[model samples]
Target: MSKMIKPWIKLIALIIALPILSYISLRVGVIPVGHTDVLALGSDASSQAMIALNDNRIPRTVVALLVGSVLGLAGLLFQLVTRNPLASPDILAVNAGASLAIVLVTLFGFSSIASFTSAALVGAFIAGVIVYLLSANGGNVMYMTLAGASLAALFSSFTQSIIAYEEGALDEVLFWLTGSVAGRSLALVTTLLPWMIVASLCVLLISKELETLSLGDQVARSLGQNVGVIKFVAVTLAVVLSAFGVALAGPIAFVGLLAPHLARYMFGTAFFARLAGSALLGSVLLLSADIFGRLVLFPREVTVGVVLAVIGGAFFIYLVSARQGVFKS
Candidate 1:
């Protein structure tokens, strides 16, 4: 009973903390706002605060929550598919594909949030297939890791070259490249939310099958599962979610890789529970990071990606050193 109740307790605690953090996110920004005055009645001083809260802070917070949730889900799915704890859209080239597509669009003078998102979908699919094919030899984890790392480097170079050629747009592209939720709006959320919802629904539908697959191919097949179909669908869902995240906030690394592991430790091996825990934990991590980024430099803001990269890079090294190439199996 104690063991069974612990997971629920952890999950509930996470769920409760999410909204509190979100509210705090709205309240805490470079421009301090009078929360009570803004909420109760509008005054001259409160007007500017309201504008910032409604236009900038709220939208940014929502995007962070949505993107974080999808990335968390995608990370868990990727881990199950690759049977690798370190697997993530950024690490596995899915975000690279999306970033490449968006960079190309921006370079061509035909860039919009919607276009970047659609292009990212195509790129993610293509990149995922390439990674799978390269690593398809008995699903060797090492080959997939090496191939993903190589492609990520190649795609990043392509992105950098394009940005360098378009010197005038370099700053704008650089911001997006660094991964941020700044300047995003509710409209961006409205545009991308459908894709996120569909992808999330797909994850829900495959939850049970994913649990089986995690047990191993032989067990899944013995239990009458179609391994190929399940793997394909699962991978597709992961790419979609990853693409949405990249489109929303350039390639925020480690949210996916870190979220799932955190969830597993808290929620045990139950698929749906782990997914929920991951999403909630991811939201907290990202929102907190964004909040931290806002204050870390005072009037100057740091991108959440850079912040996570510093943290995640350290964590990644620790993972490799500790695991020695073999993660939790």
Candidate 2:
């Protein structure tokens, strides 16, 4: 009975908490979003609350949900591929690659979301390739994580240099670097929705292969899986999803790092269940962080990225010190 009840507990808790958190997200902004205003949509209603709800809060929440889900899913895939618990865009420079590309495009006077997103995808793919090749040489999770962290630092230095010299781009650069979903428009969501959908479908299609591959290369090969192709596909999908996340939320830290581990901790390691749990946990973490950001400093809210960094950084330290076996597993 206890064993049977355990599997469904986290799912049921998530289902219950989602609507509640979402309600707080919709209502707890600088400008309160009333239930009446929400219900009044599509009718003859003209109020600041309505505009705030429809234009600002709702879109922000959606982007948070989308970005979080993508990061969580990408992290799960990456960890599976590397057999490394610490593998994630935040730690592995995947987000840094996308961030650098977006910064470059913006500096070149290209401000369109589509252009930024395309550049991000290319940059993320390049980063993924470099990390994989270098890590392949070492053939261990620690070496791979260190390689990724080094690359992330290098990319971040480049990003900061660009922002330093180009004073005019500072404001825009800082906003993205800080990483918030606030003040984003629905147009951003619409622009990235198709790519997100396409990536998700790709995940679903390759999930079986992923499950088999998770069992170790020797086992998977014995099971007739093409190891190289599976790794390539999984890595590519992870990069695409990471790019989408960075494009949406400006390299928000550690959703990828934290979400999958939390999901696996809570739900156990069934491949599909872990994936779904990761997505759900990611959404909760980001949305809750955003809400906390809004309320913590009152009028001067911290960026969601800052909130995540504080939380994730601490969590990361705990993993390193307390759960060192995370890498071995």
Candidate 3:
């Protein structure tokens, strides 16, 4: 089957799908809430259904959108910078770095949302810089990915070790490490929105520069775009975007890896179209996964992170195998 569509048309379809899926997500949760429950919020007396919608369901749905869109955009930027289809925050250890930072912050007993967000931004940037330097020859997909994987392993080891020894903060850290948007609050949404908005604006401002950079460093420099500054700002924005996603939902994997492929396959990689398509597709994917997690086992729910990890792992293998000609036959 062919995988091509006009960017606007595809974006329109995804825009339509997102709200429909969001409505379905609200309706198909473990509890019995539905449109009626949402409609009754204006009543003077509050009900259990309304409470669930206000407290639990709505926040998770919003967080899914927040995490998904940012991760998708970051993935696209990662690919543009690395010139590798497989480049993403997850594959490159950005999420793991942010996760380690959050764990360290938690270990110190700083429980504020501001502290968490700041730690994630700093940690993600630092980890991203290390990977960037280590993989300075980043055009080789394997070398860069391995660099990221090594860092991910090292960071995960530290995160796990801390979790093992610090039994006191285990419950909080464990739930956070699970990487689901299920328990987030509107307060968090408010706190994260500003940073996301700022980073997004920066990305938009530099999109043309980035497109030029994608042509190649020499080409970009010859065209008078400041290659170094553009690369630095672009990579920093990507890290910040990935970090915020991790802060919103701990280490949710693959939306960053998977969403870009889906977007490019659909929208043909013209920057703006790819950008919009990636964001919409990512939101739909994560939200759908969250809904599936809720209903797949009835009363018991799987985390969205686990769902994406499985999907991402399979996709990663397929990508590698295809590169090795395993799928040619």
lDDT of each: 0.84, 0.86, 0.85
| Candidate 2: regions farther than 4 A off | 6-9, 326-329
Total residue pair clashes for candidate 2? 0
In candidate 2, what residue range of length 10 has the lowest lDDT sum?
A: 1-10
Q: For residues 36-97, what per-residue lDDT tens digits would candidate 2 score against the true structure?
A: 77677667566889878878888888888889889988999898888888899878889998
Q: lDDT, candidate 1, residue 240?
A: 92
Once fitted onto the true fold, the runs of candidate 1 whose alpha carbons sit more than 4 angstroms away are 1-4, 37-46, 325-329
> Which of the two, 1 or 2, has more TM-score?
2
Quality of model 2 by C-alpha lDDT: 0.86
Tens digits of per-residue lDDT for model 1, 1-329: 43567677778998898888888888887788766744643344547778887778878888899889899999898988899777888889999999998888877876777687888999899888898899888777778888888999999999888888886865676787888977775876898898788888889878899998988999999999999899989988899999999888888998988888888877786568887888788888888889999889988998899888888888888877888756422
Model 2 misses residue 38 by how many Å? 2.5
**TM-scores across all candidates?**
0.93, 0.94, 0.94
lDDT of 1 at 150: 92
As a whole number from 0 to 100, the lDDT of residue 292 in candidate 1 is: 91
